[model samples]
Target: MLRALGLAVLLAATTIAAAPSASAVTRTAVGGGTGIIFRLKPTPETPTSYYICTLTAVGRDSAGNLVGLTNAHCFIDEQGNKLVGERVYRDTSPAGTAFSPAPIADSRPDLETGAIGTVTYVSTPNNLLNSGPKGLDYAVIKLDESRVAPTSTVGQVTITSIGAPPANGTRMCKEGHRTGLTCGKKLGTNGIWFTHLIWTDGGDSGSPVVSGQTLVGNAWGAQHSSPILSIIDAMNTQGGVGAGFHLAT
Candidate 1:
């Protein structure tokens, strides 16, 4: 596995305490919830097309802003709308259900590709940016104000509190829409860079790596060609994740 060396630094910015408490974080579904998915064209010769893969809910940032996380390759296109995007729609549940879909306005453009038409469950913001590692293969989209409202059925993941990276062999866990919830350990933490031997796959990218409700990192690429979470600190310093050179607050 390719191991990169970097130093982890404490962000000087004051931690945003106004964010939701750890108890607010919840897991609605595994590999199921309402989230945006991207479909890429097979080859240059193939007609440009895209499709919605799955719908899942990510956690809100320190600012109480909900961000959409997914695979970067999933957002590619050949012609128009190369970055295929859509909104999440939770399956309607019975009354008093614990999980529900967030309220999102129809703000996405009406179009079609590969027989798929306009996605109306959630609106696609005009300023969404690809805030993830190019080689790591992840993408993040900031949810607009109109879509930030809490959902009755959609549970949110809490960003783990920022801290020094875990030492080698430290135990950790991840709750993703695909793999449900699984546990692993910190295999390496060389300076601010390292890799883990966690078991993850394609749909697992963009899932948050947590140690108790604190945000350690988001799943990026894997160590053994599997899947792994790319530490947000490393990505911020390396200029992979976050927008306009701004790190997550």
Candidate 2:
């Protein structure tokens, strides 16, 4: 349960779903504000831990792969380390029609539960801190099209456009899996980070921050004082897997 308040978790983590049944008909709905959890074993003696976070967005990469966005911390280990090929699972919670991951200390992950995606790209901790004031704290997950029906809307919030961060005092809302939908006015933007009056919870990392249909940033912390990561700056600066990412149509 890392609160994910840190813009960059310590050093660098250079490391680095769910399917529906046929009878169920509808596939798992994965998009912005989706609750997701990933496991970390760390070592053989240590018990595996399930950490939860929110998915920011779902879209296609420049290479045409179905990809999703979230805070890089969601994919990292206890020490905040990440592995490139690490797997990701969904935490549909109690509201959705899917398996909810119950963390068992030493029990193996429910391999029966399908993985939604694998980590394709991450803005490493070293890179985040060194990348300047607004260091990117995001990760891109290459999703499985068969397991999910990707959409840009989360609940009542629909992300129809991607644009620059809104001006100071502009209204902003975030659709998060943990906290649901909460909104406030943008406090201000400094460098690559923007402060907001929004309230968030521990598992709300990577929640999409939007102004109307335009997505402006990603929730980066649990408190209102924590700055939001600018999505446009992150993508433009990183310029690789997540480059030119747009909301799924």
Return the top candidate by TM-score: 2
User: How does candidate 2 fare on TM-score?
Assistant: 0.73
lDDT of 2 by residue, 1-249 (tens): 334532111222222223246454445678887777665345212314456677888987676778888886666655656656767767645322113322222122223345778887766431333333334567888887766778777766798777776788888888776667888888875445677888776667788888897777788763332233355456656776667676777
For residues 7-44, write the lDDT of model 1, one tens digit per residue.
Answer: 01122222212323444543333221233333323321
- What TM-score does candidate 1 get on C-alpha atoms? 0.45
Taking every candidate in turn, the Cα RMSD to the unseen true structure, in Å, is: 15.0, 7.3
Give candidate 1's error at residue 110 in angstroms: 16
Error of 2 at 104 (Å): 13
RMSD of 2: 7.3
